[model samples]
Target: MKPLNIFYAEPDADRWFKYDRYPRRLIRRIFRGPQRPGGVMMVAINLMKGLDRLNIPYRFNDYRYINKHPEELACIIGKPQVLFNREWKNPVLFGAGVFSHPIDHAKLFEQYPNLVKILVAGEWMRDMFEPYYGDKVQAWPVGIDTLHWAPQAIEKTHDFLIYDKTRWINEGLPQPFIEPLLQTLNKRGLSYRIIRYGSYNSDELKQKLHTSKAAIFLCEHETQGLAYQQMLATNTPVLAWDKGGYWLDPEYYPHRVQYSPVSSTSYWDARCGLKFSGHDDFEATLDTFMQNLHNYTPRDFILDDLTLEKCALKYVDIVKSISE
Candidate 1:
């Protein structure tokens, strides 16, 4: 049988850029999709390459054509705030995180019973969606292109690279946690640089990761922690927070948003890196991290779990299972 036509949704144009000159830019025009300053765009681009490698025919954000033809597959690749219609017969939500409220997701699923599958980023998400969507939800984290993201033979530039995003403060993590952590690091006379969200583009970010010895990631929450994984892909050990935040009100900005004890969605480990619970835990772990940074072989963990080929093969299997 001929492969199904996969209509992949494109990332928001304004939120992303075209960095084709970068060596890491995967398959030309097709795989070279828009790039957000962060990891989301890279995830979309990698998935595009995976689709190409598997010979799955695809189009980006052109819903009119896919909508007109009911037989093709519609793949939503990011947070679906708008521009989605329940028109396609084989609709699959791939790598979607917590964009809508739980109640909203339930309504969408009920409205579109033809929705074949909802592939999310981690087991935590799978658990979140399973109760409402039943067996349709599955875990499918974004894969890494290890070829471009792997550890290099270059010299390490910084002792500790602080990967903190301002969004974390708004979304979940408060200043109490972040400010004190930074103060503690400064007091220890640690050499570090803080790279905020919009400070670097895709190529520059990759280059920065390659040069860094270690990182401290302070993000609110992630379905898969793509940036954290990217840091690990560079063999750069990371210390991340294990907790996350959620929306209780689901009505407004930071809508009833507050920190909650939640399961991590990444393949984090001592071998790759560490996760701290609070200020005390982080402070306690700092000494161990500095002393044995070399012992943490994060690149290997990423290679084993988050590689392009591995993700593509899994995607193909999922598609086949649904199509057949």
Candidate 2:
């Protein structure tokens, strides 16, 4: 098996605080432990873990080694500036938030002619990028760590765990979406808990999932929603807000670009749970979801396609395709 060269230069060394001197750095390490990884950093982290579990040979962020062996396939997973002053002589798989969009870095292709492939998290993202980059764009999602996110033996306490991650402020306030759901839960006399995105950590979420019978995922759309998938891995079904329409990202919607048929959960099926477009349909859908909760086998879906080893093997295949 050929060794892969992977590079990720994000969540920079000075992300938490400036450790200009040894004393400050020591204090930070002693007090704060380590800074928690953000979304992009987690993608790189999980991919490496998957590779490790598969026992696949790979070099991580070894520029000097890569320079010596220029013939090997190199993957730049994030942060475009990693290639600014460096000269990589091999074909590269570039994306996972390398840029906000292809148009943002219009000259990148000309600058780095060796970037043979563009990586996006899902088919919808690939669709958005396909026009600009053609067949070079590929969809690949990082696998969830199912072992750590498995169902716990604890008793389920709450009927619902509302996950709030809605990001479009101009479309209107979150109250329009959330208030109705809360009312429904209240009227039914169901116990529930609300967890806003970015306000909680993984350990906190895992505990909540263990105690909750189901989840109400409130998100505009997802490239690949790892949190909801984590919920699925725990056998906690989700009632997702999948208001399918034009890609309404304020940065690139209506004015700059227009795309359609986006999703909240990119890799989902009927077995996962239910979906509601908005307030009009949410009530009906929620009732149906509650009635059919016992029929959902979400964990089986995760085990089938999104396991660490399975996704690692898929990644290996992508690397091999580009190399050949």
lDDT winner among the candidates? 2
Q: Model 2 misses residue 152 by how many Å?
A: 1.3
**How far does residue 85 in candidate 1 sit from its true spot (Å)?**
3.3
Candidate 1 weakest lDDT stretch, 10 residues: 6-15
Model 1 residue 105 CA deviation in Å: 3.4
* lDDT (Cα atoms) of all candidates against the true structure: 0.67, 0.85
TM-scores for candidates 1 onward, in order: 0.79, 0.92
lDDT (0-100) at residue 261 of candidate 1? 37
Span of ten consecutive residues with least summed lDDT in model 2:
11-20
Writing each residue's lDDT as its tens digit, candidate 1 over 1-324 gives: 344444434433332447534444444435756545345556667877776766766677766676677665656666453325344565555445335434455666676666677777777666666777788788887688777777788887777778775353444655445788888888888877778766666577777777778888876566677777888888888877665555233363355333243444356766787777667788878877888878999888888888877887777677778777
Evaluate model 2: give its TM-score.
0.92
Q: Over 4 Å off in model 2, which ranges?
A: 11-33, 169-176
Q: Write the per-residue lDDT of candidate 2 for residues 58-143, one digit (tens) a residue.
A: 88999888887877778888877776546779777886656656777666668889988888889998988888888888999888
